[model samples]
Structure formats: structure tokens, C-alpha cells
Target: MNLGLKTAVAAFALTTMALTAASAETRVTYKSAKTGSSYYQMGVELAEAMKAGTDGDISVTVEESQGSVQNVMEVRARGGDYVFTTPPALVGLAQGGKAMFEGKGDPAFDEIRALFPIPSLTMHFVMSADSGVTDISGLAGKTILLGKGSFGATEGEKYLDLFGLTDQVEIADAELSNAVAALKNGQIDGFVTAGSYPAPNVIEAAASTPVTVLSMSDAQVAETKRTKLTIPAGTYAGQDSDIATTSLPVVAFTTTKMDDDTAYALTKTFWDNKAKLGDTSPWWNGVDPAMLSNIEGKIHPGAVRYYEEAGIALSDAQK
Candidate 1:
């Protein structure tokens, strides 16, 4: 080969190597809830924080999803690298392939790993005053609205089973917006949703109708306590008193496919900038350092390392 041709070839190889190295920085896609939901907003905030904290070493992109179940499926499909999910949905997917994942494509859910918990989603059983359904027990023979393909429906069914009202009540599945409209038009006696306090749909429904947030029976509350779930007082409009209800921890997780160093960096970035991220949503205000230890699923080795360095202990399930 001519000397000029050899020089050109070497230069081309060097350029290609540099470009590959530049593009090799970790890039993660985070699947969040629907556009207007709190989870979506939180995901955006977390992504931004990660980008800034990592100093461009990692880039996170946010993707909108239906909710917990969809988020899990997306991550499993390699559509995203991380997702926001609740314990019930994750456990459902992991345990028996039940709930929204029942009979769907097979995914190794056990391979999913937990990163951290954000906040708790309180279950709200809201009924119109005119429906005369003041508490959970009053829903017998009534049509109740549960969001279509939502974790809310799964939790609602569990509530029905606990109260033994499954057969006695008619379950109507609809989207949140549609469910709110149905509740306003008296098409449904009650609506069951689980999310952060002051959910916009619940607020809109309460604005249109005289609604009451039902409290769980003592027995029901006792049963839920085993899972460390609780609903605090005055979570929504017209909910003047404390309501006893179950809650599920909202956790961020990733699959085992994610590299240990990247997961460690992402986890550290989130917690290290918790104060800054808290300003993005009211949910973050409730984030406690201790909650990091209270997550489900196997903790990613990377996250486990970061937590250990930060002096946070992992729960048996997380370990």
C-alpha cells in the first residue's frame, strides 16, 4: 500500500474509535405513568437530577406509560431501563403472574430489581353522597368504577375480597377521565383509585359531586397493616376526617440487565440530590432516608453498594 493510503486508514480508525467512546456513556430510558400523573412528573424530575448529578456521564430519558403494570412490561421488553411501580403490582407480576400481567407474554419478573421507594400510594374509595354509600360496606349491589388496566383495579379487587363483596358488587372498568365522568353522571356508584394524595381525578370528581372518601373497617385496616400500608388524614377534598385505608409503596426499579456501576451511579445521583428533586413534586417531600431500606424485590447489586456506602441497610426482601 502507498504511504499516503496507510496514513488515511490509520486516521479513519482513530476517528471511529473516538466516536464510539463518546457514544458509550450510559443512556437510560425511564418509563413513567401517563403524562399528567404524579409519577410522570416525578420521573422527569429524577431524570433531570440524574443528568445534572452525573455531570453528563449518564443520560436519562423519560417515557410516558399507562401505569405500574405497563411500566413493568416496558422494562421487561427492553423498551425502557427503569420504571415506577407499586409493590402490589410488582409482587403480582413476580409471584403468580396475576393482576394486569395475568396470561400476558411471559417475562422473568423475578429478574427485576428495586432501586428505591419514592412515596406511598393511598387507596381511595370515593362515593357520591347521593349514592348513600358512605363506607366500603355500602357498595353492595352497586356499580363501582375501577380504572381500566390499572393497579387501582387490582387493589380494588383485593379490597372486595377482603370485604367479601366481590360477587355482590358490579365492577365497571374505565379510564380515569371516563370514570370521573361516569361518577359525575351517576353512572357509577363509586370510584376506586390508588395514588398519591390529592389525585387530580379524585379532586375533579369531588368538585362535581358531594363525595365521601370511605374509611376501611378496623379488620380491613389490620389486614393491610401486615404490608405496611396506611392512608393518612385529609388526603383529598371533602375528606375532612382521617380515613383508614391500605397503601402501596411507589418504588423505582430496573432489570438485572442494567450494569452494576450504572445502577449505582443512578441510585446515588437520586439520593444525593434529594433536596433539589423534592422541589419538583409534593410526593418527594415525604421521601425518608429510611424508606430506602424498605423496598421490595432484589436490590440491584449496584444500588446495594451505593446504599451500603451511604449507611442504609437493605430489607431482607431487597437483599
Candidate 2:
């Protein structure tokens, strides 16, 4: 071949190889709850659905994390491409830098962008029936396990503060599975867990021993209006009555580093295959396209464009 023709052909081959590699797969990481937790399971399911919906163009790796607070920090540090977190934690970190972000020397966390809202998490304060604790008031002067460095732990402290029991009760830090084990062995009076109804850890503990899922007092519920939630009747084993408590909205978010095309594609793939995703877990049943724009942190511009194009109005908060 002529020298000029050979050079042009070699450049074209290299460009073809690079384009092939880029189109072959896009690897992304997802930070979720600790292993064996509901949030983690949901992340796995989402990763699967996304891969299938995109025809394997996107591959998501699910990494175990300490739930919302840790996930937020990880996302800020670019530890993962996507994260499962709560709205309150995102708002606190982004707007006021409160809670876990307080005095952490990090500037206000405004770079994270919301993708979509998942299920709402209901806080459960489960006590051993044998502990002689029946309600929130009985937690005083007793040790309670709150998942350390987790969103649950922060909320647990807030509940104690609102009820004037912070000084009276002894606070212990542990993960959910360990906390349940502690409750079973009488090492702790009660432990706080927040997630969708019929949390696996709570169910596993209730099956082995008698457990009391405590309810918040009317006055206490009124004090924290933002987290008001209820555990409906027949939601858990051995629990026949509804328990009024606190709750928070769980959302999926990504950082500003995510490209707009990828973000838009991921968002579209999720909603397009949402029904199939919901079939895998009840947690997805609560996901509403209309609620996508209702999230606290700024919505991803790609997601915003997708929703707007689909005729879904952006809430004032999202705007």
C-alpha cells in the first residue's frame, strides 16, 4: 500500500478499537448499605435491572457501606458512582452541613445530585420483650444500640434528645445484625433500625425471641414532625398492631462528575423497567416518577431533562 494510505488505515483501525472498547461496557460503582441489609439488597437488584435494561452496556458494582451518612461521604470523595441515601441526610449535608458533616472541615456538600426517590424508611426501636420495656419512655436508663456512624445512629440520638433521655439512657454503637444479636443475648435493652417494613434483621430477631417494636409517644412524634412515620399492622411477625414512629425518604444520587448522557441513560433505564424492578422487591413499589423531582438535593440536570421531556413537572424544590 502507498505510505499515505497505510497511515490513514492505521489511524482508522486505532479509532475503531477505541470506540469498540468504549461501547463494550461502562463500569460504575454503587455504594449501598452494609452487607445483609435491605438497602444492599436493593442495590443489587438495581444493578441487575440496569444491566439488563441497557443490554449490558452499563455494569454496576455494589459496594457495602454504612448506609446514608457514610454513602454521602463516599460519594463526596468519589468513592462510588451512585449511592443510596436519605433525603434528610442529603439536605443536612448540602444545605446546613449538620449531623455527621458538622465541623468536618468540608465545604457545604452541594455537589451531589439526586437521581430518584426510593422507598421511605420507617425507624423501628425494637426491644426484647423480656427487657420489660414497652414504649419509648421505658428506654430511659437502659442501653440502646444505634448503628454507629450511620444515619440511624444520628436519628437515634435526635430521638433521645427530643424525649429528654440522652442523659438517662446509655447509647451503644453497633451494626444492625450485631445489634439484633446483642438484643437477643440481653447485652442491650433495645436497638434502633430504620428501613422499609418487615426489615430482615428485625424479623430474624423476632422469630428467635419475643420482641417488642416500640411506638413513639404522641408528644414525641409531634416534636419531630419531619420524621413522622408509621409501621402498619401485620407488617412484621408477631406484631399485630400499627406502631407510629419516624421515617425518612431514601433516594439514589450521583455526583457532578457523572456525565449528563450517562446520568440520563441510567435514569431512563430505571424508570422504563421499574415494574420489573418492583416485582423483585416491594421497596421499589413506592418509587414514583412524579416524586423524582421532589427530592431535597438538586436533581441531576440529565434526570431533570428526562423527566421534563416525559411531561413530569419539576417541583419547586427541585427547580
Candidate 3:
């Protein structure tokens, strides 16, 4: 071959190899919560963790989600390398076509499989005004923003009716991202958000304006039948006492469309780098192998491989 021709051919070969390597890189779509929420923040952190953990071999694209219901519903359309976070109870509902998913059942819902637990979805009823009532009843007569189509919104509605505040409190319908600003501007009295404790949006609102995290009493906790959680005093700005609340177990899951190798890598990287992630974000510290029992349906085969090798026990249902 002539010199120029040989050089051109070599360059073409290198370009082809580069494209091939790029194509081999696995790209994932991670759906969690809307922007400004702590769950969304965790999705961002998980994306970063995946990039670092897999040495750039596996990349995650974090997408803004309205709520866990949206995340679960998207499983119908999402196929390859798709992952999302939702409470286990929602997974069961989706499979059974119950609650918000009533009559919306699709065979795709059956493909959803559990990956790993990220953090519990702790309920937060944040208020900037002093309603004089210590528990959630104080929310009565206050305008509270419960963003649409999220676990928080659904739970908030139920809590209002359950605690007898439905008509008493004004509902400010808005996007969750605007909540902190709304509270600070006196546009809304408070908002309900569900994410890990020490939620970023709550902290932001409290720091900007004195805020109260409404607590629930023991009987009220029993009435809700959700897991009880206590945010210790000093957990939030200007909050002098501990706040009692309920939390829903949230787990990351993917469909059968994902390859086992990618699932295994993601799960392994999560537990391996969890401590480092927690150092930067307190929410990650809430995750541990013990929470694996919370996963509903069958655990992903790839995640099962990691848990087995790590000697972590899995509930019979999870196995």
C-alpha cells in the first residue's frame, strides 16, 4: 500500500475500534423522584457511583420521576438497562393491579425484579408556620402543597382523611421542586415529601425559614400501620425535638430485559461503595444487607449472585 493510503486505513481502523468500544459500554436509565427531592439526589449519587464503580464500563442516566408510581408504571415501556426505585408495597400493587394501578395492569409489570435497597421513604410534613398543634393535626387550617402523582401525595391525601384534616387544610397543588421556595416565600404553609430522613428539601426550607416537621402519636402510628421512624432532635434546622413519622421501604429494581452481568455489577458496586457514598450523603448510611428482606417478588438473579457470594441471607420470597 502507498504511504498515504496506509495512514488513512490505519486511522479508519482506530476510529472503528473506538466506536465499537463505546457501543460496548452499557448505559442505564435510573428513574427515582422529581428534582430537588432527596430520592432524586440519591439517583444522581447512584449515577456517579455506577460510573466510578464500573470504571466507566456501566453508565447510569438519572431521569426525573414524579413519584414511585410513575417509576413502576414506566416499566411497561422501559426495556433494556432500565432501573427505578419504588416502595415494595407499590410493586405488589402494580403486580396485582391495585390502588393507583387499578385496571392498568400490563404483562410488563411481571418483568419487574428487585435489585437492592437504597433507602426507606420516610414521610415528612414540613411546615414553616407554628400551627400550635404538635402532631399532624396541626396541619389543619394550613395550606399544604402535596405534589401530584407521587407516593408522598397519595400518602398525604390518605393521612389528611385518616387524621381528619382533609377539608380543614388548603391543598396547594404544585411541583415538588418549588416547595422549599414556596414555604420560604409564604406562598404555602407547608408541604409533604417522602424520601430518606434529613431530606435535602426539608433542610433547605427549614434553613431558609423556621420550620416544623409534624410528628404522629403512638395511636396515630398504629392507625397508619406503616413502619415507625423517629428523626432525632437536631436532624433539621430550628427543630428542637425529635419528630415521629412513618417510612416505606424503597428498593431499586429492573426488568427481565436487563442482562445479568449489568445487574450484578450495579448491585456489587452499590454495597461496595456504600460507605463512601454515606460519608458524602447521610441517606446512604441507612442501607445494609439486612434490608434485603424487604424486597418483594423475586430478587434479580444478578443481585442474588452478589448476595450469595457476600453471604447475605435472602428471604424465601426474595430467593
Q: Highest TM-score: give the candidate number.
A: 3
Task: Determine the C-alpha RMSD for candidate 3 after optimal superposition of all C-alphas.
Answer: 3.7
lDDT of candidate 1 over 104-214, digit per residue (tens): 646557667888777677788989888998778899999988777567777888778878899999988576668778988889988999777656678888888889888
Top of the candidates by lDDT:
3
- The model with the greater lDDT, 1 or 3, is 3
Give the per-residue lDDT digits (tens) of candidate 2, residues 171-219.
Answer: 7756766987788788998888877766777888888788889988778
For each candidate in turn, the TM-score is: 0.71, 0.73, 0.79
> Which whole-number lDDT from 0 to 100 does residue 276 have in model 1?
84
Worst 10 residues of 2 by lDDT: 79-88
Error of 3 at 254 (Å): 0.6
Clashing pairs in 3: none
The candidates, ranked best first by TM-score, are: 3, 2, 1
Scored against the true structure, residue 120 in model 2 reaches a CA lDDT of 74
Rate residue 33 of model 3 by lDDT.
Answer: 84
What lDDT score belongs to each candidate, Candidate 1 first? 0.76, 0.77, 0.87
